[model samples]
Target: METPGNEERRPPTVPEGIPLLDEEAKLPQNERPELLIITGMSGAGRSRTAAALEDLDWYVVDNLPPRMLAALARMMTPGEGGVHRLAAVVDVRSREFFAELVSVLDQLRLQGTDYRIVFLDADDDVLVRRYESVRRPHPLQGDGRLLDGITEERQLLAHLRRRADVLIDTTDLSVHDLARKVREVVAGESDRPLRLTVVSFGFKYGLPLDADHVVDVRFLTNPYWVSELRHLTGTDEPVRDYVLGQRGATEFADRYVDALAPVLDGYIDELKPFVTIAVGCTGGKHRSVAMAEAIAQRLRDRGQSVRTLHRDLGRE
Candidate 1:
């Protein structure tokens, strides 16, 4: 029998999982931690996700038992160790302890702990490649083919998958993408760069796939109707002048930016890193492009570093 290096070093017993204690900390504290429970398909980038959280200044614990989450939380005092946030990375290596996770979550909820779960997922082929590249057998593989182990593990994790607060599919994601996704979800509360994306799109081309906020510029007068501006795009001086001079153009831009200020402030307060705003017009060639540029200038004036993407710019 040939054994791989990782298989030989891997531990057989899985630890019990639990959140931190509430009994010892009955008294109020100055700073309370926001707990994040990181669990997902093995080889699906759980380790990478944890590393991203750590880089964001979260107090992270790996391979913890479900029964100890409360006790562990009680031990940390906020100011003493810059731990306003905590994360626990757990897996299904231990069968008996894995079953206790649902109950542990119930306990945390009853105690009023604000916690969230982030589950990582990937395609079966991707999982297999990752496992084979590392030459490590699946944690649940007792005696079976590699795919058999993967199948069994997926079935085992089905319940948790349903309950996950955040699910990330890493099938086509790179390491940097994984990190960026995590940073976006958590808002890098510890301090990270803010990412602002303004997507200009055409209503006829459907909608931007990843837009968190959508702004419709189709209500504005269309430059396509005027024969003189018909051939010109929004970037052209004459088209820009025409679009901005429309009846409600400046009003819409000013009002939307004013309304967005509070939302952006909330994101910053909550420690979120990225938000995408999609601006759309009928054809995406003139009116939408002009309005997108206007909104982007406003965002930049607010000190936000903005990236403008014209999704249907050349399609017309």
Candidate 2:
């Protein structure tokens, strides 16, 4: 099958930065192996995305040549306690073998195999900065400038990018954000329920870039000001009581969770399994910690999956 970018013909525009799958993405339930092809620009967070999928219990193979994909897919056996979710990182690292990818993908579809392609991308400037920060040369750069390598790669990947089921733009995404995006794309593949992570952070330490929602608890009285609560963390009984005892603290927690009700429902409907809600205050040790716990508890009480992390707790 001829790819879209050949003969100077433009490919149909697909959705970008979201998991809007193509019509072909919906495979009939059968014995075919499930596969995810991870490809894109070298500095576009493919490695990190693969790591995140690994953490999600996916069987991840990094820098796999295009030819090996068929063999790997043949080995996958669904519901036999074997690797069912196979994620292969195929890219320019395969050199000339990479050009065989489009044909291989077409063959997979023709064979009725279930697979989806996720292409990661970033701005040229961001790609250049990433390579320079690591003091590494771009793979295709040879003796040319980094921009030359980026341009070469973009041209090489244009067709795949257009054909991808999910196109993630990592120009401004943090590692955690990228991981969350990965989760959003593959969440439906697993039986796990939606998981919410409530992070307690200090505003002074900077915002949590992966946060889906940020709540400020600075309006509450500072526990540090209270002589007895100064040395105790929010987990301590006295500190917890002190912070929640504030006039509007409990009300805020209840109302805030209520406000997030629709948003959480929307995430579940959209198959986004991971959510990070950050609670911030002057310092992470006191108000933020208490409020995060309160919010997490509310979520748990509603039978939603919840976990808590105190990011800046020990910083002070």
Candidate 3:
């Protein structure tokens, strides 16, 4: 009979037949249903993570109050309500309801309900940029500056960060990278391999936002000057050969990939999931695409996982 606003006034009373802490722990780990509590900094990719989990067939509830976790957990039973995987996006937006999270989590543990917490975080500068991009005020910002709210949130979440089963820092991660990390975590894949995305773009169209590294191929001879090559795209054999046959093209690709050896190794060592290498030219039709393909080939030859994206490839 406990209500959301009354959580601080009294602890939630578990319904009858719901196993208490001692009894719950005795059940095998696999026997217990899955409950994932998603929380963390406001702009730290919580929504994206939730969407990813949903794509993986998880039942996701957003902005759920912590006090309701036990009730939701009951529905997560395989037979009782048929929801095996449940992910709750809980955060400070619940206002006072969020204050009960710590006690509620402890209560769940004592009652024997097994759950895992994933905490997402990002650098302050990155968070600020995200907020500015979205034009949304931080939930705790009130009238203060964005940093003030972020600072307050960090202070409040410090304990939970330490308690989290998984802590993901999204400072350098793109949304796709975040999704891959979430999938890996859910699948219990401990050794995550680094995935690479090489994007071909035009300098005139601006740089790719998710690019971790950028290589300008405009230094090479412009194939656009060749009347026959101008009509063909990079995928055409003639354009590909012409572009890669430029004076410094092959040497540049070899040296750049060599230079990236340590950087790529460092990324893997640090457990970073994805790196985007953007190759750009004046128009993105010729040199950039060819170089991107060559770079991706070199990466694949070194046994790296790589995918190529041609942005602005047909814009001309």
In candidate 2, what are the lDDT values of residues 161-210, reduced to their tens digit?
Answer: 99999999999999877877888775353345678999999999999999
Q: 1-316 in candidate 3: lDDT tens per residue?
A: 6778765453344785564465334445545578999999999999999987876667999999999999999877664457888999999999989999999999999998888999999999999999999999999999999999999999999999999999999999999788878888764544545789999999999999999999988888888999878898887899999988878889999999999999998886555668999999998999999999999999999989899999998898
How does residue 14 of candidate 3 score in lDDT? 79
Number of the top TM-score candidate: 2
Off by over 4 Å in 3: 1-31, 79-81, 189-316
* TM-score, cand. 2: 0.54
- Candidate 3 has a TM-score of 0.52
Task: Provide the TM-score for each candidate, comma-separated.
Answer: 0.51, 0.54, 0.52
Q: How many backbone clashes does candidate 3 have?
A: 4
lDDT of each: 0.83, 0.88, 0.89
After superposition on all CA atoms, how large is the RMSD of candidate 1? 19.5
How many clashes (backbone N, Cα, C below 3 Å) per candidate?
16, 0, 4
Ranking by lDDT: 3, 2, 1
